[model samples]
Target chain A: MKPIIEISGISKRFRISHELQPYLNIRDRVSQIFSGKKATSTEEFWALKDITFSVEAGESIGIIGKNGAGKSTLLKILSKITPPSSGKIISRGRIASLLEVGTGFHPELTGRENIFLNGSILGMRKNEIQGKFDEIVDFSGVEKFLDTPLKHYSSGMQLRLAFAVAAFLEPEILIIDEVLAVGDAEFQKKCMGKMDEVSKSGRTILFVSHNMGAVSNLCSKAVLLRDGKIAMIDNSSKVVEQYLHDSVQMSGKRRKTISALDKSFTLQLPYWVNNAGEEIPSYSFGSDYKLRFDFEFHRELTFLNIGIAVMNKDGSRIFTSHSVDDKSFQSFSTYNGKMTFDAHLNIPDLAPGYYQVLFGVADEHTHDYVNASSEVEVILDIAETHKIKDGANGILWHTGQWKKVG
Target chain B: MEYEIKPAGRFSLNLSELWEYRELIFFFTWRDIKVKYKQTFFGAAWAVIQPLLLMVVFTVFFARNFTIESGNIPYPVFVFSGLLLWNVFANGLSNAGNSMVANANIIKKIYFPRLIIPISSILSAMVDFLISIIVYFCVLFFYGLQSTIPSILLMLPLSLLITLCTTLGAGSFLAALNVKYRDFRYVIPFLIQVLMFMTPIIYPVSTPDMEWVRTLLLLNPMTGAIDLIRSAVMQVPVNQTAVAMASVSSLLWLIIGISYFRRTEYYFADLA
Candidate 1:
């Protein structure tokens, strides 16, 4: 089978001007023209360099990259919103891109009118929109406010309406950006389900996202981009693992030490330690992890509290732990000397992914907070030898046993 | 199902591609017309109010002060006739000139025939012109002016066609230029202001004292459409030479405007 879209050696270059002003007035332009001054003070920056890729029919390809990795640029070039500075792209079948929701929606227009307006903007014919208008309104659940102007609808409602229009668009190839980042969790799930249905119907999809979980779930193949070039192209899981590994290394060391200027105290951490008190970058799933902190104080300290927070890659806090939360450590005061503090946290059966630990110290009475100089990354790798099947489904592994009562 | 986009060169008019997107053009024009009066208190009345009010002001000031000849026609009707066409040209030109910048969001996100923006703007202006013509007929009735039914029917649409063509020409030129150098925004309204006086909207083209000035006015593309309209609708004698000159110039402006617009439209998404 032939590929539906083929891109070869595509590159985009934008000229960066050093001048303070982004735009010139008519007077300055006229004077410059008369004076014959050349405007050559520009630096060329390539947003994409020789990116080559192709997608077969009915394939869903996920493009994973950090900001400025040319993901959006590649999508824009494919959508024909902007021309590439060099290279060629050959595409078959109708193409529609949803870089943003509500691209042409008018604030003053009623929800009903905006549906048609946005539908046509996405290349839907009038009859096609009319045919599925009721389905769209039903999916959006904005039936009560259909006649009201879009400005009166809440942002969530507006987003649902916009998504409905794009969802109903039956193009052969659909290009989507990070539009799923909006709305609540339930709505995101619904959007993901809708995209899954579309892909199941044998449509070509090019999805760009920062959410590794969504990309892994929806895409069979993934392309990782770094520094405007293809870093790796492989199965979704392997690409995501490589991307996570590369990101961890890019941040350099995980352990750090900080000494107070007044010599009041010094905090040091050797590394992230497992339950066995051994340094490790990764831990087996469903195991307790420990972090040991050594502190030295020249002056006596009172009412010192230690805190730790575990966060996911997207900076969402998984949970927080503090010494104050424990009954024995409350109201504890330390003398002027060396002391060791240890935090033991049981890792919930978390899905196999990277997590980070944040440490901070504070006075309970004064509420004066001191941040840790560095954070540690905890990689919860699925145990290779254990072979626990179907356990690592969601963020937490709920251990509810199933019984064949019938 | 298949499309190719390459860097645009000197002149390429994708007329077939434009035709394929005819529905979008219709939607854009309809949206503009609907949104124009959507929340307004006066609704469509504002369309007629503009040219009607301008005619009253010009008739009060110019007819009262100067001994202007209107070919034995009433000054109010004469000026209104001229204002009718002028309103279309001026409104259409200004609307089309700013349409690209106004629809910058859509232009940046979607790929369509960029010419649709300016064309739809002109189409909306034509709607306003059509509304104002009804008032033109009432004014003709009030003044008790008699014109040959056949000639009025024939000349009305022809004059409107010429005005529409001229507006499209100048409007697209300014629209394309405005995307790069927004100075055209300030320049358009001022140009229209000076052009109103130059095109014999308030004064007759054939001023008895200044043959040289009359000949110069004849060179203006609008002078021909105005003279043709006056001759056909008001039964004024036609200036054959002026009509020929105006027709030729208007066509020339149309050709040049479209060619220039087609050449530069590809870069609008980047520059705008």
Candidate 2:
């Protein structure tokens, strides 16, 4: 079977001039013309370079990258929103891009009128939109307000209506770029289910999103981009794993520079260690691990409090542990001059994959912490050691006690 | 279904792509018309009232003050016919000139034939043109001016076509220029004001007995269009040279405008 989309040697160069304004006004242009002064210097920056990739029919490919990694540039080129500076893209089927929802929705027009307008703007035929008008209204769940002007609708309702129009676009290939970032969680889930259904029905999908879990779950293969080039092209799960591992290493380097700059007191980078004091790279899932944080106080201190928070890859905190929560550890407030303290944190039942450990220090009385406040991120990798099938659903892998009641 | 996208030529007029997006053009035009009169108190009546009010002011100021001969037709009826077509050209030109900036949100997000924006702006103005035409006929009837049905049918369409072409050409050119320079935003309204006087909408083109003034007024592409509509309704003989000049100038403007627009439309999403 032939590939549905063929992209070869694609690159986009943006000429960025460091001017006072992004756009020139008539006065500046007129002055330049009369004075005969050449325009300011401009630097050519490549947003994407030599990006060659192809997708087979019925394949769902996820393009994963960090911010400014050229992911959006590649998608825009494919969608024909912007032309590449060099190279060509041969696409075999009609491509509809949903880079943003409600591309041409008019605020003064009614919901019914906007549906047709927005549908046509998305490249859908009038008859096709008419056929799916009921379905779209049903999907958006805004039937009661169909005749109401769009300006009266809440922003969320407009978003749903916009999303509904895009969802029904039956193009052979769909290029979506982070459009799911907004909307409520329930609506997001609905969009995901709809996209999954579309992919399963033998259509090509190119998805670009920051949600690694969604990318891994929805796509069979993934392309990891770094610095405007393809870093890896492999199975979705493996590429996500590689991306997480490399990201942790980068954050680790950043962690060092942060701690090294502090002169008043030294706080060593947090790491996982076994009971024997040997540092370990990863901990087993559903097992206990000791988190050691060593800090040296240069001067006398009082009411010093410490806290730890474990966050998942998405930067959402799973749980937090504060030294003030424990009655025994609360008294170690005063620190003599040049005294070193080792705070051992024993956290258990974390699921597999990488997490960021946030360590914070505060003062209860003076409220004068480390230059106001400090939170250091340390990468914690956990390996899968769960005996249960399919591992776990959340960050925690706790095995609760189950007993029969008489 | 299969297509290859590459760097487009600077002067490629991709009409097939424009044809493919015809529905979007209709939707855009419909949206404009709906939004234009959405919350207004008089609604479509404003289309009639605008030119009627302008005619009333011109009759009071120009018709009574100057002894300008408008053939056998009443001066109010004569000026109303010119205002009908003139309003279409002026309003269409203004709307088209700003269409690109007005729809910057859509341009930045999706891909479609960018010409649709300017073209739809012109089309929306035609709706008002139709409304104003009906009101002009009522004024013509009030003045007891009778125009042959065949002449009205033939001349009205020809005159409208000329006005449409002139507006499209100039409107699109201004739209593209507005996106790049933004100076045209202020320049367009001023240009429209200058063009209204230059087109002989209030006074007869013949009133300026100087050959140079008459020639200069005829040079404006809109002069022929407004003259054609006025003569067609008033049963006055049309000037062959003026109509010929209008056609050639309108065609030139159309080519220059569309070519410039096509060359620069690719950068609109970035610069708009």
lDDT for A378 in candidate 1 is 32
Badly placed stretches (over 4 Å) of model 1 are A20-40, A251-406, B146-150, B208-215
- For candidate 1, what is the DockQ-based docking class? acceptable
Highest TM-score against the true fold, candidate? 2
lDDT of each: 0.80, 0.82
* TM-scores for the candidates: 0.80, 0.81
Clashing pairs in 2: none
lDDT of 2 by residue, A1-406 (tens): 6789999999889998776566788998899899997567789999999999899999999998766789988988888778888999999999999988998888889899999999999999999999999999999999999999999999889999999999999999999988886676599889989999999999999999866657877899999999899999998988877877776666434444223233546666666777677666777665566776666666666666677777675546688887778777647656655443444555666667887566666767523244211233466788766467664567677667879998
Candidate 1: lDDT of A383?
40
Summarize candidate 1's per-residue lDDT along B73-119 as a digit string, tens digits: 88888898798889889989999999988998998888788888899
TM-score of 2: 0.81
